[model samples]
Target: MGGAALAAGGLLLPGTAQAAPRLTTPSPVALDLPTVPAPRSERTAGSALRPFGRHLAFGADPSQQVVVSWQVPDAVTAPFVRIGVQPGDFGAPVAAEVRTLVSKLSWQKPVEDQPPVKPTTVTQYYLHAQLDQLIPDTTYYYVVGHQGYDPAGQHTRLGDVASFRTAPAPGRGAGFTFTAFGDQGIGYNAAATGHLIAGLDPAFHLHMGDLSYANAGGSGKTSDAYDARLWDSFFVQNDPVASRTPWMPAIGNHEMEPWYGSDGYGGMRARFTTPDNAWSQSTGIYSWRYQNVGLISLDGNDVCYNTPANLDYTKGKQKKWLESRLAALRADSGIDFIVVYLHQCTYSTCHDNGAELGAQQDWAPLFDKYQVDLVLSGHNHVYERTDPIRAGKATRKVASGDTVNPVKDGTTYVVAGGGGGGLYSFPVSDTYLGHETGNDKPVPMVVSERGGHEQTVKVTWSRVRYTGYCLVAVDVTPGAAGKPARMEVRSLTEDGTAVDRVTVQRG
Candidate 1:
């Protein structure tokens, strides 16, 4: 098989016989920024060059393509990936592309009251190998190596190799499970959650954004608190799970580093390559399909009224694209469920950051119109699930273990923000598995308004709220013709305790 290059229009072009594996060109934003060498202290000493932050992501079509990404501590002669159908038998090496990112020194403080910070310059090298034409429902083993090191050589170790299974073909009716969470930072809790998800053996994981929290301040403004080294810790912590699972991500406000680009997505684009099925070449907003399920990732910052720094950046283009994608998915005969995940919440009872009016006003209507099965978000650090909602009200109260039919009822919104971050409190009483405290009063929470303002509002749709570190796993059971498909959405704590569960069925 021959490798190909990704064209500017997101098409694959045949590579010449003599041409090495082609790489995607650097983004215009990255090309315009200046790059500098890392400080002596930050440079890799006399150690062998090794890869870290190894992770996988599905391409436009998960059934036939995947993108393997990793980072090197220092500049290497030639970095490549050796892949094969069997373990320890990687045939030929596929050349990898390097994306270099630079974070210059900053003396300004994120907050006026903070003390001046020391200056530091950091540079990172991210490598990616886009593997296409893979067999569906097959596992492929791979290892990363450079000129001085070879995994298949005599010095290979068991830990040097990793494998990933591609999604089944469309209409395959293959039952699969995937996990979702957000607001995961680098910490003990976060690491525990990663191990828990890996234990569940999910085919893929949806990171609802606020990934590394390198930028402690989520204001999306230029902050001196930003530390590029934090990303190193984050990837290392999650490498155990991310190396084998497709860790798909959504863009959150904390990901908005003003120093990166106009919309603050230059770093993200360089770090991870997502599906290119979005409008206007947006990296954060894209859609993909696996078996009988259709999944869409959105950039909530563009429509987040709470964080107005990048608000309306898309000029309503994202919403338009979303509607079209939803319509297409709803029209597809093979797609039994449509799930959307983003950073901010359309409805949440977290007092810190409740409902995002921007998203509710712009995208919720489309979810209702298309009858989306489930919506997931992670802005507030807690777990909350709403009743089947339509037109800003709960059509029916859906408790845990209850079944929901989006076609007849409405979409269900879930807030699984408790992904290892500090837990947040809700205006309503806590209610979940093993711990249930009923709340009869209307929960008074803050609603995001335009221009970075907040308004107090009382609502009764707040059903389940659990303040703890947790993640959500969704198991999809495909249905045959004339039968209804089922999806079991379960919320589990870092210790693997089920906090909440709900079944979604579609006819």
Candidate 2:
């Protein structure tokens, strides 16, 4: 909010890899960073067009842990990530799992064509192995490759070593830095946006949803491929931004599926893995603690597509989990504050689009009841914020000197759906209608093109028919002069400059 309007936090601190293209016994996959033309529509362009990479990202392991992953191309043979502290911090090296190339681009494959089937292009996924419990506020080094046993124990790794800093503990003088941007899937200025975002150089990044146009069709692999490739190649692949910074993502309608994949989210599941067993839950919805912040990531896919077999998700399970998670967090003495992220904004007219009424009805009460601080979401493919709403009433936005919001356990919601999927061209002309049922922001409802059964027919949870992608960044600092620093949320334009911003503080 400092740019548009912001409060302050404690202090600030800051912040890729590569692989092979082909496959052979000893590292055959060659990986190239695709500089896609427009709307980055393909994993590998047939022959002429440029292969694109867009959604580059990184995620944290609680506070000390930072993991990085990205896509590899078909030309490079064996691929892996390099590790170190800074540019030359390569004193000691750490490596993560070595990934093979993705043979079949499509999710539906004959049992006969598994693994390397339809090997037209190779999309390798790599991680920064074992970035385990690190010291808060410390930076690490890395490069792109692995000490693989390539052909008779030959080793291979393509990129150079890079550096990244861990999140600072709240008790550590100033703290950490994070940023959030939603609704960026247009592919229009995605590459530029990634570069723009990369310049800010925070500790970690957060995404709202709608990562790719392919996901709009709801193919599980398509969506995940977008995540891996875009993240590494365009967003983080050869880039150091994500190689060292952590990434936190919220489930979006595009990533949900009964529509494609062997089960659901085959791509998402394969592309990124979270600590599901930690809280005993599957899917993207889970929670982790970062410094003094308790962050919760939710599986909004279930919010739109509710079912029991999806029992892993659904209303009943989430409600129970929410209560239990909050209870534990509140009970703990170490936690300083709480924040939550998901694909749906609690206060929006599009609630009906994604059939989000169920989610809102179920979660809003819990947020209000628990005083969950802040909520981040994407769906409108635009950015909007509330001035601290409690039970549908406007409270004041938190500012300097304010100790806490007077409202009991109140929260502020932000809609940030823009991560290169697509861009929207709608204005908040009227109140949103359909399945959504919450109104907690200034008028001029932020909305997008109404996706329909066709959209849903192709993807899972068609309830909220729409398109676009998004990401978020957070900066955590100790309170200023005894007051908590403001929490800011913003939306970036295709060029990567802030379009709007809002600051959140205790009432």
Candidate 3:
């Protein structure tokens, strides 16, 4: 294999004798940026430490394990979490580990002769507590605090406590709901979406990627200004919903912070703890099974063409792991559905970012082979869905409210990018649940390819397109002895207006 192919984790062909090249992570970039302290407003007050940006994630097993993560503005002593089955009676204090991130700054000159960029250094402290051996299908109340600041203290208020429920045990045949979206940044719309998700009361949430746009530039190049504090605002904004629901996430191009690590995932690694059930060395790639549904989070940067900074960093291990995971999930009769989520679009018509051909070439075939039920993506800043597709072509047009059977038809792709980022436009007119712009002519759009080539192609699979801020809520009902499993997917705007709906079923 060629050097670029080998570097991107391509497998060697049979009868090839050349040894695989050794892969090494690039050393962190040193840009000599200035160091700054946490603003006075963010620091803790005299002995009263406050934790923000609280979120949750299921471990390898959702029924018996959960990882609780939260952030403190500044350094503190003896940080820990207290949890119990009752609201006011936490059993014992669970010590938490602190992950500290020192973020350096970089500036981008969009044009020549631009003035020098002034950047700020941001240091963040994140604490995590892993709770295991928990009862299934039960709600647990919890509070996060450090020395001299216990939320369970008699003087503390009721609002300080948050709760989360564990998923049902294996083969429980219990039904549940979950919400998903991507490209969510900190803003009024982002906060509104969070509230809408909270109202839905999903069992958990899937964040497709581009969580906090601290680095405004989506390009993997380190030339953009990096303001790490934007993460603080993002976490605080989503705290209401994330603190209560497991906020699972995939990594996107914007997540590639150049100054932190070789692939710019050091910050994300320190802030979130996801399931460690996939390739051991890969970040933002993991899988978990909750009742009858199997969820997989993939790192699109590994196979993206538009943003190739961390392209193929996995060395083919991620794809190999994905195939293996899919096979195992399919083998198990208990798993009735498989949903894969990533940042870049495998099939989208958004003129701004278009579709990622690398993903379409590398992963879509595996998706087809495994018969994945649903594929969710972001990075386009709009809501778009494709007809049930196989081999890059639409098998059939599935309108809003239509039901599809992946077992007979093909996998469905949804671009739920309207998760609070500014909207992007489609080459054609808008069409959604309540409104339809009767403009369905075939339009040419760009397809991002490896080596930075843009290919123009005309596509007809762009079925439902909504140019507004929205979130996707899915209700999963497990199949019984004589019945089939079903998932009802709904796209709702920021104000809880339904714009699109579809159903997927498997026998």
Candidate 4:
């Protein structure tokens, strides 16, 4: 650390003592501030229009740090954030830290596909602040937003105040709970998923992507054709659940740009703050370690298949980082296990349609080499469990000297795409897969096209892999790397009722 670092709320300033670090952001909406632009309707109804947070998500900045983020609504407006310890109310000097969203950014074309063009007319602003040096396992309360904004429908008095408990730090703890799911955008099913999560009250929530669905209640109009949809309005409707939880996320095609190039994941990216200076600094591809669990997120939006350049920039970099991360973890030998999270799937019942990534063939080897414990992903929608294996072959050898049963105690693949978007039809199709040989190595589990001699129409697994939603609760019992982390996978229905449960016992 440096003098500047120390000046950054770490300790006392040059003259006086420094207060504890506060992580907070100003309200997202500005009302009649006479500063920002007004909507065409300007239906600034109900004198008490209040601005509240829109997509509240949290990520562990270590047991000592917590990153909080939300959108600020308009570019012209700035955020007013505050933070403090729990068991105490916010706004109390003992608990509050305030900061201004005064940072500016000038974007250069990404190295991907670059072409100079006019700057975007509309810019999205994000509010970010970090709560640091916090005590572990303690509750923290926070509130965000302003008192008046048109769309909020009314003047806001008190912003929503939510509390969360910090996870125990490494070496100082043994176990904890957190929820992981993907594809549950916003809608009837998504709302139900949210309820289940709220009930669980895990330390944090990770959405595997596909979080939007059409009409149940959202601001956007035509979001319903699968991946893009959400409740009534994908953006607004999705806020209820997210506003209270520190929702960490993964990506899916739903987050991709309709145009496929410029500023993809537009609003979503702008609305969240990720570790910008850490390893894999790109928001889409970042890594954060919480307690004993280290999560690595990827951007499968690499877009092209088999091409060296594409692999080099996207998957290649990810693979290299994975290797480095694994090597470092192995050398340390202290963490309970290494868990990898991403949006694409390696094991699926949907089969070949998603085979273009060749993740099973390419990434499986790395997972095995590193002895990764669990690999969670979305995009397929439905849920799947893979027999532990190393690169298509089983871990044990058969009499004939062939790998038997393929997978083992070391690692298992999970397809958790189902998060409320679209559901895919199960059973893989061989005929449809014939086309994939160019990009995919056929897995025995995929369904074939020819069953009946007369009429052969195979019911291939479609988006189900990505559509089937569920929340996985991992109970990290005491152990070492490669050891099973007692896990309970729960699949709930549209009403938040538990429908399926799978328990993985430790070896």
Candidate 5:
């Protein structure tokens, strides 16, 4: 266990674009990389300490591949990962590829008490071990540590052998469940929601964005005071849940700190091991499949207006790639549902967060044209769901308890931002629970976006709006030859109550 002690694959590298070269799996021997040492100043953060923030992500392929990643505060001697089916008998250990991020912050400069030194870069090492050809739907025990602190070695008795299960075989109709939420910062509610998600036992967890709020400045401009050390606390806080479940995340505005790199996701790319099949170098956009569902993680910052940091950074290439992917997925008979997740909400009523007009212009029409089953988003720190929509209009009055067939009713947009961050308020009272529960009168809601654009609309389409920390659990039941497939999406509160739920059926 690194940081705070918490209980914690290679398929072909698929290119993001159709024209991109398909990456073949590298030879096993090709995974080796030379070791790097921790800087003098940053070594105090714990260079050779136990690993922490252990989490998982899918490689190009979900079933036969998985990426195990963790963080070491300082430089490690020889960081590696050992895996096996048994709890304590890892036969061979695979060396982990280490990537370090050094943040040059003024506050990190040596103080009066310390030896006078040049501006010290607060260095943090992120280690990743790619496990390929893993058995599908099977649990494997693994441990992450360096040379001296080896968990599999005889001298060390570290009881940090964690386990993770690979995704079920794609198109196998294995019937798996996945959970998702965004805007999860470090807090009690976020930790509670994570535990609830783990209780639900989802195969993977989708963190739409705004992961740690480390880059607290929502705007992508230069931070007032960027603190790279915050990730140490946030990852430790989230270890209870993310340590076990695969924490697949999308890039958010907060993740785009201008001090880091172009488009502000250089820090993110260093930490996460998301699929790089896309053409975007930021590693913000990628796609993967789990059973009969196709999940696309988009870079909402490319279309977000409030932040405007990296708007159009992709030069509309992400949209083109997305359209191509959606069209291909829709044409595939085996893919019954397409769920796209991003940071900004494409359609949300909260005036604070507003609607992501860039997302609307770039991807909403494509979602409508392809009839995407579900669009999940964050940025707005509340749980909000739109009625089945087509061309920015309600296709069906999606009241709670109504089962919607997206093929006929269009797509349902979900704003699941309440994942531990401070909740934001809505301009109008909530329609579902606001007036129905003896609160203020449910006034007509106004959807606001960038450029001071606001539209006062009736509340007939906003079916479920819950203001609290929650996680969305989606169960995909594949349909047979003659039967229709069913998906039950539930927004569970920190207390494990289903605050909002919807059933989407497709034949």
Candidate 6:
């Protein structure tokens, strides 16, 4: 079949399937910031206070190093992490660094006629400890606390112990699985998606950003309805699975807090412990290698059209860093595949912010140039996938049961933004990937979001599109020169149904 043309208004030819109507962007209405009734005293019992938001992250090397992080309600002295192979015996404790963030919110009175709501100060404490020289592919138990609140205490039960396994040794050619999604907030759907991701027992998980939506208004305005308490609730909701899995992430637009320090990642830096390899100030743009897969997490906010706050923060430094990283990874003989992830997708047919032109312009060429295998993203709160694309167009159609060789063809883009946010609709029919058949007509597409104009160009590259809370689970098998590696990607719905699947081969 012939490809669809980019018609006027950045849409697919009219009458092609249409996406559901765009969601009403939440306005920055006057909102009262939650008040903390009691301030944290200078002295507090540590051992009795258990950590809530326990999470894991990888350093420059996944196998040799892992970063353990968590949050405490009050300031605790000498916060640290204890790690050991055996559950019962946690070896010597490694000192953790404490970073305290105070969010100052000045909410304007909704009704000028009434008394104005006073400003509020919300202070939070976060702790991080890096565990080095860890054994590969070995599970290690850990506990987080300071002098008074040690989870290893006799009173602390076994259930309080959290554990994680390091990545497999490099060039081991071992098989492993990982999952990814984005746009999750404090909701039932997000919780449900976390439960589903846990079922997969992935080695690590990637969150493409828009984490909690604590700032209901996604725009990066200081006056945009700020509530710091929502983060506490959101972390608790995610603690079930994130406490165990290595939760790596890329910066989303919502994470941009202009009210805070440099580049709006100030809050993010205090919350999570990421590799200290970002070009800009703690933007979470870095690269790492796990066995045969070389992974990169880009800061999509730098190249996003919808959120132009802090535009050109890197002034093309990020793009240059990405190209260098991709080239190095591709040249490595042990590396079999290159996977890049970010918040905004480079290709999608979602109604609101379909394919972001900034992403395509800034990074798509680099992906094509490097022959990156799979690009994962989530921002539109839906599931969408593109066929093998080259030069901003589909080189060939990809369907379920199809095996694609990224080394031979181009990269495949995936939008797994349905991690518990409200579902989005296709402009036309709901054409599921593996379950439904496709129509010949063109579909609605958003071409750009410049000056509030969301332009779209309809094309046949949309191989799979599903409207539901979903995520991507990928099982990877490493291989040498003679034997090519295989990545089996499965898109699953909330009910554990397999919406779509594809095999990507790389040598």
TM-score of each: 0.89, 0.67, 0.88, 0.66, 0.86, 0.88
Model 1, runs deviating above 4 Å: 1-47, 107-120
lDDT of 6 by residue, 1-507 (tens): 001221212222222111212223343544575443333342235544567887788887888889887877765667778888999788877987666666664531222222343435566766778788999888899888676667777666677788898887897637899999999988899999999989999988999988988776677776666676678888889887988898888888778766555566667777777776754344678888888899999988777777677667788889889999999998998888899989987888777767778888989999999899999999888888878999988888778778888877799999999998777777766667556766746566786665546766767788787888999999998764577789999999988898889999964
**TM-score (C-alpha, index-matched) for candidate 6:** 0.88
lDDT of 1: 0.82
Query: What lDDT is reached at residue 404 by model 3?
Result: 93
- On lDDT, who's better, 4 or 5? 5
Clashing pairs in 3: 9-315, 9-316, 108-223, 433-499
List, residue by residue over 1-507, the lDDT tens digit for candidate 3.
001111111121111211222224344555675344344334444245578899998887899999889987666667789998999888778988777666544343322232344334455777888899999999999999876678887666578799999998988847999999999998999988899999999999999999888888877777866677788889999999999999999998898877655767767777788876675436789988889898899999998888888888898988999999999999988899999999999999898998888889889999999999999999999999888999988888788989999987899999999899888998778898868665666766689888999998998888899999999999999887788889999999999998989999975
Best of the two (2, 6) by lDDT: 6
Clashing pairs in 1: none
In candidate 2, what are the lDDT values of residues 108-180, reduced to their tens digit?
Answer: 3322443322333334443324456666666665554332322112232233344667666645636666766
* CA displacement after TM-score superposition, residue 431 of candidate 1 (Å): 1.0
Query: What do the candidate models score in CA lDDT, each in turn?
Result: 0.82, 0.47, 0.82, 0.48, 0.75, 0.78
lDDT, residue 110, candidate 3: 22
Candidate 4, 287: how far from true, in Å? 1.5
TM-score of candidate 2 versus the correct structure, residues matched by position? 0.67
Winner on lDDT between 4 and 6 is 6
lDDT of 5 at 254: 84
Model 5, residue pairs in steric clash: 2-50, 2-51, 9-130, 9-131, 9-132, 10-132, 15-277, 16-277, 16-278
lDDT (Cα, tens digit) per residue for candidate 4, span 1-507: 001111211211221112222223334665534344344113233223233344444454556766555443332222334444642345522221222111111221222332343222322334445566877877776655432222212432244555556667666666766677777755577666677777776667777655553222221222313222121255455556565566777655455432212324333443455544224235466666666666766655443232112233353666676677767765554554567777666555564234323465457777888777777877666665454556554443111111112125446566766666656644543211112212232333442212211212222122112234566666556554876555554445445544344444444
Q: Estimate, for each residue in 211-317, the C-alpha lDDT of model 1 and write its tens digit.
A: 99888887988743777677888888988899999999999888987777677766777688888777545868999998888999999998888788888898888
